[model samples]
Structures are given as C-alpha cells and as structure tokens.
Target: MFKRSTLSLGGTALCGALLASGCANHLQQRSEHEERVERKLLDHTLQVDIGEPKSLELPQRRIRIHEQKTFEVTEFEVTRNYDRYTPYQPWRELYEVPLGAVAIVAGVGANILNVFMLGHLPDSVTKDWIDNGVAGINPFMNIQSHGRAQQNLASIDEVQRDRRTESTSLPWSERPVEVQAGTQSYTLTTDRSGVLRLSLLDSPFAEQDLSHVMRLRISVEDDQDNVRSDISLPISGSLRGKLLEAHALIYDDLEDDDVSQWVHRVKRLSELGLEEEASELEQSLIELTHNDPELQKQFLKSLTRDAGRLVADPQASN
Candidate 1:
C-alpha cells in the first residue's frame, strides 16, 4: 500500500513538471515571434531619416520632397482633381472666306468689266465725275480733238527775215558785237532786240566759205515773244582757236578777281573733269543767286554759254 501511494504521488509530480515545462516552452516561442515582428517593423522605420521623431498624433499621410531641402505631406482625401485646360484654335474663327475665293471673285469681276468696256470709255473715272458723261462714250473722239487743237503755229520764215533787217540797222556801241581773230579785233552793230547781224558782213571768209561761221542767235522770250537777244558767231579754223583762248582768259580773270571763296572753288571745280561734282556746284551757285540776283544771273548765263560752246566744239575736249 505504501509503495502504491508513493508511486501515485510520483506520477502526479511528473505530470505537473511536464505541464509546467510545456507552458514555459510555449511562452518562450510566443515571446520570440513578437520580437521578430518588432525587429522587422523597426528595420523599415530605420530605412528613412525623418528628422527627430516627434509625437505627431495626426493621421498617417504620404510625404514628398517639394523642392530643395523641403518635404510636404499630401493627404489623399484632402487633395482635389481638376480637368486639363486646352486652348481654342484661332485659324478656324478668323478666316471667313474659303481659301482663295476672295481673289478669284475679284479677278472674275475685273475681267467682266474689261470685256464690257474695251476702248469706248476712259480707263479710270473719279468718284466725283462718275455720272457726268455716258458710260461708254468713244475715247477716239478725245484723241481726235487733241490732234485738231495743235494745228496752228507761228510763221518762222517771216519772223527770221524781220529779225535780220532790224539787227542790221542799229548803232555800233549800243549793239556791240565783238570778233576776236588771232589777237586782232573787230566790232559790229546789233538790232533793236540786241541781235548782231552775221550775213550782212562782207568778209573774205564769207565770200569764199560761209560755213566757216556758225551764226547762233540766242533770244530770251517771254510768252513766245522775243524780249532779249544775243548773237554768237563762232568762226572756224585759227579764229575759233583765238576766241576760245580769249574766253578762257576772261574766265580766269573773273575767277581771280572774285571775292567769294565759294565762287573761286566752283570755278576751279568746273575746270576739273568731274561732271557730277560740277553739277552740285551749280546747284550751290543757284542758291547764291537768290541773295545776289543780278550777279548770279550773269554768272549763270556766261557759264551756260561756255558749256554750250564746249559741247558744240568736240575738239575742245582734247
């Protein structure tokens, strides 16, 4: 009986020991599982350095880097979505006509008008005179009237004969005509109109070869009537050479005596071969003439005559 009791007590003690050991093993496994879960969560948290960890008891939100050295929390529920905006096309709204319709219509209208009005009417008409005459009045009549209006002209032969007769009768001093012949000189009379008669002279050259002298009468006319006249008889051969030399001397004398430096420069430039430069100088001379009218007029007339003589005598270019 004693043995059996001892056995029972031992059995009871063993069962209790076994149960306690199992309970301790189970508790140790549960503690190890919790530690592993905690380590995993801590590892994830350690991956990011969100400054000093503060006790921010707010809602969980995603943070993004906004700019340099800055972070912003964006809550999904708080942000609003907007529709994308697009601009309207202007080409469709601005253009009214179909591509080239305006140009086509204008060209067709012009062709129709041209076909209807050929040579009957004037090509253009002002708005003020649109209804003054018939639309297709004959334009040929306008041309015919213009031609008929230019039929009358002055009698040139009678005028020349009268001018010649008047020029031969005047005194020598009042109508002074100078002829320079190789250092020798001769004087002649002029008409009432200051024109010198060339044909009336009974010279040795005139009897033999009349063509030696080119009789040029320069007349200043006011409204188709002669107001003033000057005759230039350019002699041929050695006489022409002497006259040209005398003209050159006269030009040089005037230039040397002139007080204005501008005139001196202009005269000097005219002697040069610069036509464009001389023309510009002439324009300046014209302006100067406005201040001294008579002097300017005389200078211009002399310069013009000199230029005319230079043009007529091709040998003068050499």
Candidate 2:
C-alpha cells in the first residue's frame, strides 16, 4: 500500500512539472515577424532641399531640411483591448443613449413634415438630426468631453514592455546647427519649421568672402550620429562672384558719389539681380536729395527699365 501511494504521488508531481515547462515555452515563443523587427534598422536622415529664388542672401533662400530621426527606435505604445466607444465620456453616454432615442424620433417627425410640406423644408434640417441621432445611438461620439482619453496624445512613458524597431518619425525641430564656411564658422538655429534661413549679410559670411569657398559644410551637433552627420552645400561660382561684387558695392562710398555715379550703382545692382539692395539704395537716394522732386524724378528717369521701376516706370533701353 505504501509503495503504491509513493508511485501515485510521484506521477502527479511529474505531470505538474511538465505543465509548468510547457507554459514557460509558450510564453517565451516569438513570431518570425517579431524576430525580423528586432533585427531591422529604421532609416533616419536630415534631408536638405535647395528650394526657390536660389539667393543665399534673402529669406527666400530655400535651404529647408526635412529632419526625421527614425532609427533603432524602441516603440512603447500603451495598448489594451478598448471598445469602439472608448473616446466617449462615461457620464455623457448615460444621457446620450436616451437623448439619441428622442433625437431619432424628432428626425422621423422632421422628415415626415418635409414630406407633408411637399419639400418646402431643406433636406439638411432632417438630415442633421438624423445623423446626430445615429451617432448618439451608435455609442461612438460623446456630446460633451472632459478630455480624459485625449490625454493619451499628451504623454508617453514605458508601460507593459518595449517594442523594438518600429518605424516612426522623431521631429527635428528647433535644433542648433553649426555651419562652417572657409575660415568662418557660424552657429545657426533652425526654426520650428526646420528651415535654416542663412542671413548672408547678417552672419559672419558677410565679412568673409563666399566667392573663394567651393562648398560649406553644416554639421548636426550633439545628436544621433546615425543621421546625416555633415551636409555639404555647394556655392555656385556665379552666385559667389555676384556676392563679391555686391559686397564691394555695399562698402563703397555711395554718399561720396554724385548723381550719375549713384545712378550707375543702382543700375549695376539691378543688373546683378540685387533688386532688394537696389530698392534700398533708391530709398537712400530719395533721402539724399530730399524735397528735390525734379532731381529725384530726373534721376529715376535717366535709369533704364533694367534698373527697376521701384520709384517710377522707366522706359527700357535696348
């Protein structure tokens, strides 16, 4: 009898051990997709686009960077089985259920009235109530929201477990970028829009001649190295030459020059496609020859159409 009891007890113990081992194996099992995701590397980069106007000096200089950091990201999404009505407020649903029933009745009556009135009433009047009633009946939209579920968008923290290699965009906004041009280095900050507007005259590049440099290098600092580390922005030889000439004109003694010389400078800037600078110089000329309408008019008149009609329309010279 004792031997039989011992054998029975041992068999039960062995069965229990087997069950535990099976459970452990099931828990540890991973799908092939999960394995692939774990091994996958999400592509990330700071993409720079040379946009319109092509002037490095103006704000229209479209050096826009689409910065998306989506590499090796361990995604942690707080998830659980939620009903389709998860977005609806709890207390609101209680009243909404009955209100929906009433609204449905009202909609039916409105449609009936529309039929009786021989389509005198607008379709929207009946349709709006019907739609509203259906939504309320569907138990999806809540009438009033205290915004409890909306808070999910406001914050994210580790919950449950971390999911690896999920593709998502990490915003590259308001980041300080370092640009190096020849011997000069400037620290420029990107706006919230991720656009780097290089104020050529405002920055150190103004003092340093850009005509000599082949390309300027901009480095994304302090962040992930997996992204585009160094971006080489090419400086066109023609633009560089124009900038050099523009710089010389800027520093030149415009005040010392007589009317003809000033007119030549204005026309030169316009020819160089420096319309903004030309407009500014025209303003200075206006101030210089203050109250002399005839002088101002004559000066503008002497200018060819290529000089721009900032003051008045000028006849173009062949």
Q: Give the best candidate by lDDT.
A: 2
Q: Write the per-residue lDDT of candidate 2 for residues 113-169, one digit (tens) a residue.
A: 999899887766687677657656654455322333332222323343455555554
Off by over 4 Å in 1: 1-264, 306-318
Error of 2 at 240 (Å): 2.8
Q: TM-score for each prediction?
A: 0.16, 0.47
Lowest summed lDDT across 10 adjacent residues in model 2 is found at 23-32
Using TM-score as the measure, the top candidate is 2
lDDT of each: 0.33, 0.62
Residue 226 of model 2, lDDT score = 47
Model 2 residue runs over 4 Å out of place are 1-44, 52-60, 71-172, 199-202, 222-228, 283-295, 304-310, 313-318
Tens digits of per-residue lDDT, candidate 1, 1-318, equal: 999999999999987665333211010011111111111111100011112122211111111111111122221212222222122222322232232344345445555665787734333432212211211121111111112222222222111111111111222223344443333345554455443433311342232332234432222212322233333333334433333332333233433444354444455445543344455555655564556757665666556555531212222233
